[model samples]
Target: MKEVTPTDSEEHVRRRVSEKCSVDESPRFSRQQSFGRDIGHAAAETYLVTRLSFNLLGYLGLGYQWITRLLALACYAMLLMPGFLQVAYLYFFSPQVKRSIVYGDQPRNRLDLYLPPTSDGLKPVVIFVTGGAWIIGYKAWGSLLGLQLAERDIIVACLDYRNFPQGTISDMVGDVSHGISFVCKNISAFGGDPNRIYLMGQSAGAHISSCALIEQAIKESRGESISWSVSQIKAYFGLSGGYNLFKLVEHFHNRGLYRSIFLSIMEGKGSLEKFSPGVRLKDPRVKKAASLLHHIVLFHGSADYSIPPEASKTFADALRAVEVKTDIIIYEGKSHTDLFLQDPLRGGKDELFDHIVSMIHAEDSDALTKDAVAPERKRLVPEFLLKLAGKVSPF
Candidate 1:
């Protein structure tokens, strides 16, 4: 891990601001520049929506079950539009956000950073991978979480990678690994503590990140050279993610992700064992690799039929069997998006969010003190709308 002093951190920030200003300044053609940027953003949004619509239609034919579920999902989204729009605005225009930082040579190898206001001391960092099944994941999906964590003085790096058709499971894992390597090496320049970095992923992202972490540990156990070490990571947090693909194949198939489509996303049935973190941990050869891991934490909702809480429970059991320090927290009656999206948007006090913040601030008395007195976040959507959205949510 690289150590950075206060002076070094300040100087780095100054250089970065100077460079950004140089690139951003266009006073002579300000009007034209603004018009061009708006046009570009509009085009990008159109392309994204069109692509997602086509992909979703392709996978889920026009079956009655899918059509009904799609209708419900759309209703859920509509009910939460107020919150979504607010979050989208912050994600695209917030001064605290640094968007589209390239991490690799691939077209989609980019990430967005959410930074805290004060850079006095090194802040704990989280490299978050957002969930969008396996076909629609994007870094912007993490903006809400990033904004909340940044307010509590934590740095967040939300990563983007190639989704299905464009890239398979192997490609996604490789992209995440590369993103982690970049953060582990370069975060110090951004006033992030290299020693306190955490890895977190939601839904499909959870599975992809776990595969990358386990694969890295395996490589290290074999004395293979690597860019980043598992030891460098403080902990791994899996949020509503499926660990054993074999157990989830049928579950996902029934939920609109057909087996054939899911199989192809996982690169066929032969790769199931290779990608399943829970199953891979049972292998004798991986014991040494597993021992290298610091801690594993899994969070899930008891009512999440999308993947089921049993997935986290079983994975936790496997981690303990391997002698890895592990903990699983189940939110009773909470749905998949409730813990990740609705709860955060509903705003006041969130048990899951509190738990995460408590863990991150355990060793810092001052940080914990600040967190305890922090003002409650204002609700983005009305209580009635939130309730309606929850009832209509397909996930």
Candidate 2:
């Protein structure tokens, strides 16, 4: 967090001026300064939500704080409940609960699949990795996305990975690699096109996905083999991924040391170089090939306060510098979770679904061969739902 000073005052002044003009470093400021810079950011978010036309009546109808508080408390209880017990709540109780989403299974892991009836064959598969930073989250959060992806005729898979608070990011990605391996081995059997599989992750999940891809890229370059069946993925979609955990550790608090602790917990030691994708990019050759833009898509809300949209910008800039094909869609005023869940701030779900569909369409043809005409699609959601209705997690 501390910036180095030049012994010569003039040189120090020059460096500051240069930084101010540089797109890369200009907006990165002290946390205190950053916290205060969001007056307009807040307003912009509010305007966006209103413009998007959320159910205003729904917001108004829930009139009391006590009502909202009670609902939130109930959700908290559900989250804190033990897993086997939670399954019971999902199964025998919770009258309002819907049926569990259907998924595919490997011997050791399971995946919840969301398939759109409207489109298939050439459609892309968006593989989701939910974030809980690294310590939390499970397959349950992925259920909404299953339904979301079903709307667009694209197939979706919410993968299960190992967790931390116990394991490290590596364990998570290892599990992810295996889950993907399972998908590659058996996806076509279930009507998914393996060649078109794309990775979409949030928070810690994003970091894990990026690392796994880097590992896969490295393995491919060295002609090394891993347990996973597939080595290459078509693209990545990162939502509020923590690319620079070091920054959060160094400047914001003393928590940077936790990374070493995390490393110790996972791998029995710490190596920033081993854990960080940003650090891994120091080698120009590796960076050139591993850049996700060539095979990925990024969605980030500019107003995200938790992880800092700068992380996305940093990753995008790094990818773009290498001339990798990347598209960054920044919702002018939105936050982290808001990118995925309903955000009163910005109207983007339909657009998000639309973009996902179009991306699938674009990647479908070029996926295995050269790109082709969009397949004639009709009633994609209904048929896909029918096929998935009686299914369960396969793993």
Candidate 2 residue lDDT tens string, 163-241: 5433456667777776666555544544667777778888777888777777777676666766442334677777777
The TM-scores of all predictions, comma-separated, are 0.92, 0.61
Q: Give per-residue CA lDDT, model 1, range 180-205, as digits (tens).
A: 99888888878899999999999999
**Candidate 2 Cα misplacement greater than 4 A, ranges:** 1-108, 118-122, 227-232, 251-269, 285-293, 344-349, 363-395
The collision pairs in model 1 are none
With candidate 2 superimposed using the best TM-score fit, by how many Å does residue 392's alpha carbon deviate from the native? 34
The lDDT values for all models are 0.88, 0.53
Q: Show where candidate 1 strays beyond 4 Å.
A: 1-42, 52-56
